[model samples]
Target: MTVARRLIPCLDVKNGRVVKGVRFVELRDAGDPVACAAAYDRDGADEITFLDIGATHEARDILLDVVARTADQVFVPLTVGGGIRARSDVDAILRAGADKVSINSAAVKTPELVNEVADAYGRQALVVAIDARRVNPLDPAAGWRVYTHGGRVDTGLDAIAWADEMARRGAGEILLTSMDRDGTGEGYDLALVRAVVERVAVPVIASGGVGTLAHLEEGVRPIARGGGGADAALAATIFHDGHFSLSEAKAYLRARGVPVRATEEGR
Candidate 1:
């Protein structure tokens, strides 16, 4: 049976406020994290992601209060990332009502964290977000490299290799973001996404460069069709900027032959 593709709205939070940026820079105030989540929930977002982008960059903990608030109101699954370092962090986020926690930098700092958190909460609750950038413009063969600390620190880990390792270590899903395409809205880096998806057994959420509803449709178009065919599509700016609604995007994808959950299913 074909699994229904997911349409997720990502709210990147910094200091308790939702923000959007291009290629991880020049972040602008988007809106309240809680309010944006509630709207996406009502609009039929398959899942809601609240990433505390600055928490790790600033060496602090994610705003648990904001996580709790967003979780209390949003009915769909909620995944919170940023500042997740140890078991206590995961426990706190879960306690705050997040259905899952996404870990990036710490996962790289202590690769064992993947096993630790996945073992404690079950792999289904752990997602490893990989921020990948092309190492060689002339050829993807040089491959994409993983970056940490909100895309600031290059970990020198090969993106595809890291993804494979993360899955083996127990990540239930992979949140793959192409740093080069992020916020650019040109569309997802299919080459980068396909490389990881083809290598991993876990679900991959394709993020960045989603400027139009067509981009969402394109994200999951299937590698066989020359698209990355990510299990989920995540966008921060378009959804937050009101360029499109989750429902409208899903409807568009469904109409275009992408198998997506009916809005009523989430209801």
Candidate 2:
């Protein structure tokens, strides 16, 4: 069975407004989430991700109304995360029209949170997000470390090991972001992505650092031959900054031999 590669455009929203930043700082307004999501849906995005980057740090709940408004404007599946602390929070987010709920800080704080949510909502509805940064550029053995609270605090956990654990705990997917490569447009941390993909059974969505459409190709396909590939490629600035429309990305991947679903004329 073949799974068509997914290209998901992410909206790193803060305070109910779409925002963009490099390495999760220096945020600038992009637009309203509802409008942005509607455009992406029309452009043929496979799924939409709205992350409330400020919700966790500010210790507030996710903007459910913002999610509901965005979901109202789009027909595609929506995944939401940030400041999701308990089962009640997950329940509320799903009720707000999110198809899936991504948990990072809360999951890190309580590893069993993955199991808890999976038991209640099924694993398919739970996405465990790993915000990772390379602790040392030189040591591949030390490996990348996981961070929480919007990539601010390092949890001292090995990212690879944590990913394996999350999958074991019944997480349906892993949303892996490379903080070092984020906003730098240096391309995704393919090494880190490959490592996690190799360790986990469920699909892994590669996030951060896409400078070109080719980077998306490299992520959803192999680096060379027989190399690791992410199940999905996610980006914020690329889609939001007038870089490439979702249709163009699918066409680029199709032309490059990556197996992406064809965009219908009306989508």
State each model's CA lDDT, in order.
Answer: 0.84, 0.84
CA lDDT, candidate 1, residue 171: 99
Error of 2 at 161 (Å): 0.7
User: Which stretch of 10 consecutive residues in model 2 shows the poorest summed lDDT?
Assistant: 21-30
Off by over 4 Å in 1: 20-30, 56-62, 265-267
Off by over 4 Å in 2: 21-30, 56-62, 223-227
* Candidate 2 per-residue lDDT over residues 74-168, each given as its tens digit: 88889998778888889988998899999998898888889999999899999999999998876656699999876789899999999999999
In model 2, the Cα lDDT at residue 161 comes to 95
For candidate 1, give the lDDT of residue 252. 88
Backbone atom clashes (below 3 Å) for every candidate: 0, 0
lDDT of 2 at 238: 84
Against the correct fold, how does model 2 do in TM-score?
Answer: 0.90
